[model samples]
Structure formats: C-alpha cells, structure tokens
Target: MTRTARSRALGSRPARSRTARQHAVGLAALLLLVAAAPASASATPSPASSPARHLEGTLPSGAAYMIDTPDHWNGTVLLFSHGYRPEGSPNPAVNAPDEPTKQLLLKEGYALVGSSYATTGWSVEQAVPDQLAALDAFTKEVGAARRTLAWGQSLGGLITTTIAERYPGRIDGSLSMCGLVHGGVANWNSTLDATFALRTLLAPGAGDADVRLTGFKDAADAAASAKRLGETLGTAQNSADGRARIALAAALHAIPGWNDPRTPRPAPDDYPAQQANQYTAVRGLVAQPGFAWRAEAERRAGGNMSWNTGVDYSAMLARSSQYKEVKALYKSAGLSLRDDLRALARAPRVSAEPRAVRYMADHAAPSGRLDKPQLTIHTTGDALVPVRTESAYRQAVAEAGRSPLLRQAYTENAGHCTFSPGEQLAAVHTIDHRLTSGSWGDTSPSALNSRAQQADPTTEARYTTFRPGPYPRPFRGQGLFG
Candidate 1:
C-alpha cells in the first residue's frame, strides 16, 4: 500500500505526555544526586508455558539490567541497546524495540539483555562500560553463552558497533537499526549548519548574535531558541525565495524530502512540496524543544562538540544528491545560487573547543574497524536520524578497510525507528542466517520482503535496494573532531 493510504489508516500521532516529562525530570534529579552502589541479581519465575528464567539487577555503576533466558537454551544471547533518552527520562525495564519482537526472540530460544546505562543524556562513554558490566553480570549469574550478538537501535547502534570493534572476541555479529553511526561530531555539526542557515536566511535581525547556534545553557533556553527559529521558518515558507533558501539549507545536510510518515515521497521535480516537507521536519522535529540533545552533549563534553570552520558550501553543494532539486528551485524562484553561497561564506562560523572535541572523539565517534559481520537498516525518508547517516557510515567502513564485513538495507518509509515487527524480524533472521551458516545468504530486497511478508502480512513493504545520497556535511578526518 502507498504511504499516504497507510498514514490515513493510522491517523495523526498523539502529543508527548506531561507525565513523561515530569518523570524524566525526577529521574534526572535522582541520578545526579545519588551515588550508585553495586547490587546483586534478582531472579523471577517465568510463566509455566514459557519456561524462561528472568533476572534483574543493578551494576556497581548504578545501571539497571534485565536478562531473559529460555529453557530450550539456544546458546545465543542478543544484547539489546536502546536509543537515546533525554536526561531525566524514565529508564526502560527492557530495551527491545517492541514487546512482540522480544517475545518472539525468547520463544525462538534467544536470550535477551539490556542495560539502562549509568547516567542519561548523551552518555555513550558511560554506556560502553556499563553495558559491559551488564554482560559480565549476566555471565556470572546465568553462565556464558556459546555465541553473542550486539544489537542496538539509534545511539545504541553506535554502542553495538563499538562493542564489536573494541571487543570482537566477545561478539559474533552486530545489527544497528536507525543508528547515528556517523559519530557525534559530524551529526551535530550538520544540524548546526541547517539551524544556522535558517537563522541567517529567515531571521537575519534576531540580534542575539548567533546565540541560537551555541548559547544553550539549559533545556529552557534551548526550547526558546528552537521556538523562535521554528516560527521564523514557518513565516518564511510563505514566499518562493524563502522556500528556495530552506531547500538549500536542507540540501547542505542531505535532509530527506519526506517528514510526515502519513505522506508519500514527493516526485523528484516537486521542489515546493519537497521544501515544504523538509521545513516541517526542521521546525517541528529537528528544531523542537525536546529534541535538544546537543545542549546536553555539549555540557557533558565541557563545551561545543560541533564546528563548521573551514567548510566550503560550494564544494558541499557539488557533492549533494539534492543539488539538482536545489538548482531547480533556485532557477524557478529567480534567485541566484551564487548570492546564497556568498551569504553563507560571509556568515560567522562556529568552532568547537578542543577538550569538547576530544571528549566526543573518545566517547562517541566510531573507528569503523569491523571485526565481525555487521548489518544496518534505515528508512529512506528518515528526518530525525537522516538516511545520509547510512552513507556516511558506509564511507567510514570502507576507509577502515572493512567494507566486506558491512551490509546495509533501506526501507521506502519515512520517520525514525519506524520498522515493523516483520521488518525487524527479517533483519534479525538475516544476521542469524549469516552467523549460523558461516556465510552470507541472499540478502536481496525481494528476499527480505518475502521473509517479512511471511512473518507479518501487515509489515510495510521493503525498499532494500534504495541507496541513500551522500552525506553533504560528513567529517573528513580525525583532525576535525579527534
């Protein structure tokens, strides 16, 4: 079925609950004030029909973990790493994407495990060790598995990859779904580029002197800045020139033209519609208040972790897949591309503090040294975590001389982490097949789609053959963020 029809069937998404925000605040306060002490595992009896052993406990670092072992004992454990949660957000009891997927894996005889992490909000450094502690705790309490797979979503994707790279002997394979594998430096700098362009082209007289780009002291300040920028973009979208400018900014980062999952992908030449969709993504999702993970990242790293110094917009434009659309929009709007490029060149650029850069490099950026088979999946129209991340990651893997060990898949759908149960299962099965057979199987789109259909008829159709455009603002080398 078409995306529009599916969207109509699903209807509009609900707003975030106030209770959730409140819980986050409470959790954040508790974590900051209290010191964590080592704790032992607590075992719970499983259902009679399931016959699985469930264990829960806290680590010395104060992170909580959950483990499920089926009675059949498949000798394989799947370590699940969850996506980023804002500081103060309530910790999850289990990190699986969906309960159905969890149950299916358990029934299939795979053990499930995940940790809450030591502290929240851009805590990859803490997570790496904390997750290791969880694994060690699992081994100590439940005995070692014959094989283990590192599986994570979003930021957890990065963690999963890091585990495989840093401790290859501990993991047999890895799967990263909708992950920011491109690293913190490139991802957040790309975000800064979009926000900077918005402020410069649309709200030139804000008078805060680029404070919107870097002066976030807290969530409230970040929210206020995001609100102002969002309102400006909304007003600018009314004019042809304004829309063209938005396209240029989005193209700079290879932002997708699909934002609303309820809508279908725009036709290639539909610049106005495309820009409109991108504007909704930037303003509503990327620039939203709760979406301000950068502030926390900066605070943790001791200063700004992103920089756009020495960037050449012309060169970036030349590399972007959206260049054709951008050129078309500019020409139709009677605007000069040269003039926009000049404006970007003349704008004040942001730079990162050295210590902050080092922190991110040590804690977040992936070395791309793959020691085992790894698979990645992304939606073609993802806005929050952009499909360009997949492209950036592919480049990193290639540069590390591990291209043979990496495989990527794509879906035609929009939104972040929007995979269906069937799609998720198909990915897991693909990795499992490789591990079990000691050779990669038929991972073609048609084959995966067929597998998904068999598992769940309601699964969204797959677009595994889709190749994402190049990441326009990729980090070139270690010098920038290392």
Candidate 2:
C-alpha cells in the first residue's frame, strides 16, 4: 500500500521570537559569508547628511511596521518587502536588509519603511496588502513623497513585483532580488519535478513516493518528510551511481554546485567537486525549511498546488544548466541517463487539486502584466532561488507585451540575498535613475560593477551579462498564464 503524502489536517506554526531574519525567506539558504558583508567600518556619514527619524507601529491588521526618514529627505520613499518567514523561526518585523544598508540609504537622503506581514508562514496573501498599508501609514506619518519605489528580497521580491502589477499607481518603480518571480504554482510544481527526480532515482527502500509532499498536518509533519529525503540524499552520496543521480536531481532545479558565497566558485570542469557540493547544498534545501515552505503554501492555497503530470523529463534535462554535468557524471558512473529518465516517466505522477492552483495563481503568482518599472537582480550561482526565475519572468513579460518595463541584472556571485551593501545601493540607484530619467541608463554588468564599487569600495560587485535557460517546469496549465 502507498503511504499518504500529507494529512488533510492543518498544522500549527512553530512559536518564534521576533528577532533574527529566517534563512528560508532569505534563501541564502546556507553559507553566510562575512566577506560579502557591506557597510564598512571605516565609512562615516557625509557632513551634509543627518541621522534619520525613526518611527514604529502596528497596522490595523496587526502587522508591525517601521519607518526611517532622513533629516534631509530626498522626496523619495522606498517601500521594502521582506522574504518569506518560515513557520517557526525568530522573525523580526524588519524593513531594511541590514543596519549598514539602512543607514547608507538614509544618509543618502532616502526614506525607508517595511512591514512584518500580519502572519508569518507563506505571507504572500497578506504581504502585499500589509506593505500597501504600511505605505499608507508612511504617507500619513510624513506626508507623501515625490515618488515611491518598492523593493524586496526573496519572497519579498515577489511581493514587490505583485504591487507593481496590482497597484502601480501607488508606486513609481520597483526592484526584486532573488525572487520567486515565476509565480507560486510554478514554484511548487517545478520544485516537484526536482524532488520527484530525487525520489525516483535515489529513494531508499520504497522511496519518498510515500512521503507527504503537501497539505502537511503541521511543521513537524513536513520536517519529518524532509528528514527522510535528507537521509536518502546522504546515503546516495557514497556511491558513484548515486552521485550521478544526485546531479540529475540538482539539475532539475538548476541547483549550483558552488554552495558558499564566501568561497570562490568551482572551476567549470571540476565535476566531482561540483557534484559533492551539490550533495551538501541539496541536503540543506530538502530540510524542514524547504518542505515547510510547500506546506505553508498549501495551507494558504487550500491544497496541493503542485503537480508533475506531463512534464517532459528528457526535455527538462536538455534545458538544465547542469545538463553537461549530469551527462558527464552518468558516463563516469557507467549509468545510462536514458534509462533513469524512462524510470521517471513510468513512476506514478502527482496531481494538484484545482482549487489550490487557482488560489495560488491569483494571490502568489506574477501575472507579468507589469504596471510600473521593474529592475530585477539575482546572484548567478544562487542555490535556493536560481537565476532562471529572471529568465522565466522575462519570457512571461515579453509575452505580456510589457518587456520594456522590466530590466534584469545578475551578480557574479553565489547564494541568495547575498548582495553587498554597495550592490544593494547600486540597484536602488539604478532603479531610481530609471524612475527619474524615464529611461534605463547603461545597465550593463560593467556599469553596475563600477557603480557598486564607487558606492562601497569595501564590498565586491561582480556583475555579468548572462542569459538563463528555459524554466524546466512552467505552469502552462489553465487558471494561470492563460
């Protein structure tokens, strides 16, 4: 008999202190590099700049928010949306990414404000509204700015884009970093492709076919499921065929072999080191945070919102960034790549409940009908939220006839939300320039790098001109992108 995927019963959120930012939302999922740290110790405020006026409060919806306005206001206010908060992490109602970045922006005369969404786990439903409410509150507190710009990291990046699409008149322009820009349905569904590959090729015993993929009864249920997958991944690492299969699974999600932001990227041909890194990288991702993300999304969307009914595994491998790696590894292990994909083809497929897909599309997905100008940036080697998100969003935007409104850039770095203070400031300045000049200036990698180094010499800014491949599993199904 097949074990059930998830219990229909809803789960309770883990109690957490309102403190440090949760890694799930941040998606720098692992490896925090001190070298990437910005806000240099030697830097001092400009003589013309003064400390910001700080204000904090709770919205009527119960979301806490904070605002900071410099003494010399620039007639601009940046509305920040934070990443998704895991169910049971220490979440602080924060607006800015770091104290230094905040100070640098304020010192440069820009005001900033952000809200801790009404509730934590998978806050997309309330995140945009909470942010809009915070914007209203900010306007009431200090009068309306000349213009408002929206910006966010990770899930907040999705929220930032949603605001532009749904309520553009409220803001002039926006920026999204390391965002799940493809939409919620695509997120879950594509991830299902990756996890499905893992289970089919590497599951110990009966495999994760028995594991709960969604509608988790609670965080523990999701976590326990994640644990099983992690253990499977661990055991698979010790064998040649297992490593090859791991490469295939990682490729499905565009999981990079390079894991840390602080460390230099692995040489392109170093397949062994890369595969080993992928093993470690994917292990952390399959943990509680990853499954819990799906669980919370399911809880919000009303059911299993992801499926893999007709995804072409062969085509998916063809489009993967790590396609060559998978092939090379398979040959090294004397495994037939064709055989495994055929097995995946024969494996039982998962289907989504119609209601969940509809709910997720309306609230959590990007329609690509961009109303305001958008500047998106991503780290090239981002493990959790791959750079392909930008690629897919660009396709969606081009299809929507809104390509002119979006400008995408990439960092020659790894990890999620790992931008330095200078790089972060550079994005703000770039978007601000567009909003002001009514034209996107030279946004080339070299130009951005120059701008970042000029802003914060202490931080590194390695921008690159890159074109990401096709999104492996887009939600071309009805009720979304239709």
Candidate 3:
C-alpha cells in the first residue's frame, strides 16, 4: 500500500479491522511456504479440514515471522508479503486478504508464510531480506518445498515484484495486488505535489515560511503535521471554493474520484460528485503515517528525497483524470484556475538532496527488469495507491523490454486491496496456472471473471478490463526533476 497501500486494496473492513489486518500480514514470513494466514493470536480460526501446524518466531533482524502448514503437505508454497505498518504498530503476523481465502487455501493444502519487516512504514529496503530470512528460518524449522510462489498486498506487492525481478530463481511466479508498482520514489514525489498544493492553497499556516514538510524531528512532529493538514481539510470542505481547491490538490496525484468502497461509484460526468470524492482522497493522506513514514524513508535514504522544484501545475493538471473536475469546480466557484496555477508556480519549491535522489532511484525505484512471470491486480478506484500506478509499472516493464512477462488485471471495486476470497483465490490460481503451463493464460476480464466465479461462487466477482492514466510523477526514469 505504500498506503491503497488496500483498505483490506479493492475492499476494506472497518477502520480498526483494516489496520489490524494490514499489520498482521507484515508480521509473518520465515520458513516453509503457505497461503493461509491465521491473523492475530485472537483471530477466529480457519476451518481447514486438514490439520495445520502454526509457527511463530523473531528473525535476527528483529522482524517477526509466522507460518501455517496444512497436515497434508503440498509440494508448492505461497510466500506472502504484507502491507505497510506504522512504527510501533502492535502484533506482526500474517493476515490473508480475507478469512475464507485462508481456509480455502489450507483446505487445498497450500502452506502460508510471511514476515514483519525490520521496521515499519516505507520499509521496502528491509522487506526482501527479512522475507528471505524468514524463508531460511522456515526451511530450517519446517523443511523445504518443491516450489514457491510469491504474492503480496500493498507495499508488500512491490516487494513481491522485486523478488520476481531480482531473485526470480527463488520463486516460480508473482502476484501483486493493490500494489504501489510505480515504486516508492515515484509514490512520494507525486504525493508531494498534492501536499504542496494543499499547504500553499488551504493550510491555515499557508503564509508561514517555516512549516516543515520533511526532516521530521520525531513522531510527535509528524503527528502535528497530520493534525494540521486534517484540520485544513475539515475547514475547507465547508466551502465551495475550498472544496474546489481540494480537488486541485487531490487531482494532481490522480487520486481516484471514488473514495469509499461502501458506496457506489459516482456518475462519470458528475463533476461535483467526483470532486467531493477527491476530497476524501486528499483528506485520507492525513490518516497515513502522519508523514512519519516519509521521515523513515528520508532517514534511510540519507536526506529528503521528495520535491517540487520545477513542476508545472498547469501541465500536471492537464494530465490528471480530474482535470475537468478541477476546471468545473474552479469555474463554478468563480475562481481563476490559471491564477492558482501561477501561484503554485511562484510558491517556494522543495528540492531533492542529491544523495537522497540517488537513494530514491537505487532503493525505492523498481527496475522492472523481470526474470519471471508477474501478475499485478488493482482496484480501478483506489485513491491511496491510485490505479494509475499500474500504468506507471506497465511503462517501466515495456521500457525494460519485459512487457510480455507482466500481466495486469483489475477489479471494478472502489477501495484499496478490496478483493474477496473468491477474487484472491482466482488470482492465486491464475499465477499457479502460469507456473504450471509456462505461459500466462488469457488474463482478460471475461476469463478472469469466470475463473473468480468458479473459485468462489458465493462472492461477487467484478474483474474488468481497464487502462489506468499516466502517473503524474515518475522518479525512476526522470532525473532530479521527478
């Protein structure tokens, strides 16, 4: 999720459940592979007919790992990577996308494993190593499997791809769901555009020259920043002009106009409704790591990495899916859109430190140089890690001449990581098919939808054909400017 970083990505539960589940997946990884996660210690048990052995331990890296193996051994394994967990988050363990999927996987005899990274949010640098350590632990503790298949959600999704690209021999295939496939550098840089616009246009302390964006002093400082931005959103939502400006900020990052999975999608041409949804996306940023994760990445990278030194707001907006929404709202509010763009042009620009910029590319960016098959799935309306990120990855893969190895699918759902038990199983089966056949079978919506229905007839399957828009900012290929 780097934060669709998924509210469950395609489906989220209540706020409490979502956070708990997200953290749960991050906590488990070492040893023999499996696809069944039991969630927290107190979570309800899965009803697998085959008895399963559960194991938990801490790796040398201080990361926690968990595993569940069915009594009947399946030669193949499912190594799961989890989403982002804020530092100090409680309970690190494996959490399947949903409960039914866990039971189903175990019933079919797939072993599941995952690891909590060495650190929380933006811990991509440590994710792969931690997982591998967990794999070694699993091998020592449980024994080796004939084959391994990797799958992940949110930030873990990116880790899964990196595994496919950098260490393809370790696994046969990859499944990334609700992933920030564009990579962390691009993720933060584009987010900065929206944050910068919100700060300059609507922050209560807009005129204050000393407010900090990065280089957080501590968790308290990050919390304060989140609180301030949240207040800005709350106050801004009260006025038409304020809401219009909010659209400008959210659109800059291509935040989807559909905010809640619980609600039906807004009409395609309903500018006002879409703008309102964009407000939810912009506001949702405040609920993330309170910008502390940015600090985490900054520290690891050696300095500040995200910036807006030479961005052209007009050009940026023109590329956004919400361009018409912003124009319509601004015009309706009697605000001059060009003037606002000019104002952004004049605002103090943040510049990336060279060391950090280099770190961003080497550590955070994905080379897209794949040596194995990878399938990426996303919700079309995920605002957190917008669907456009898939577009960015598609470009990267094409550029790397590995486009044929990558297959991207989508669910017509609204929230991040919102797939059902059926949908998740369908994806797993799809990857398994490729591994067994040495080719990606038809990945079209019709084929996938039918597969999902067969996987879980009880759950609604909404897979569909889609092409996400271009990512607003890409740091991998672009040099300093991105």
Best by lDDT: 2
Local distance difference test, per candidate?
A: 0.78, 0.82, 0.79
Q: Estimate, for each residue in 1-482, the C-alpha lDDT of model 3 and write its tens digit.
A: 11001112266655668878777666654312333654574453333333457778888888888877777767667888899877667647673555688888877788888888888777878888888877787666567776788899999898888888888888888899999788877887877788788888886346323346766676667667877778877998899889889999888878878867886678988878888777777777755632767777777788777778767888989988888888999989999999888888988888877788787777657888988888999998888888899988898899999988889999998988988888888899888888789888788888888888897889979999798877667547346553
Least accurate stretch of 10 residues (summed lDDT) in model 3? 1-10
lDDT of 2 by residue, 99-161 (tens): 888888888889889989988888888888889999998877667677899999998998998
lDDT of 2 at 195: 77
What lDDT would candidate 1 get against the real structure? 0.78
Query: Each model's TM-score, in the order given?
Result: 0.85, 0.87, 0.86
C-alpha positional error of residue 388 in candidate 2 after TM-score superposition, expressed in Å: 0.4
Per-residue lDDT tens digits for candidate 1, residues 376-416, read 99988777788888888899889999998898998878888
- By TM-score, the best candidate is 2
Error of 1 at 396 (Å): 1.9
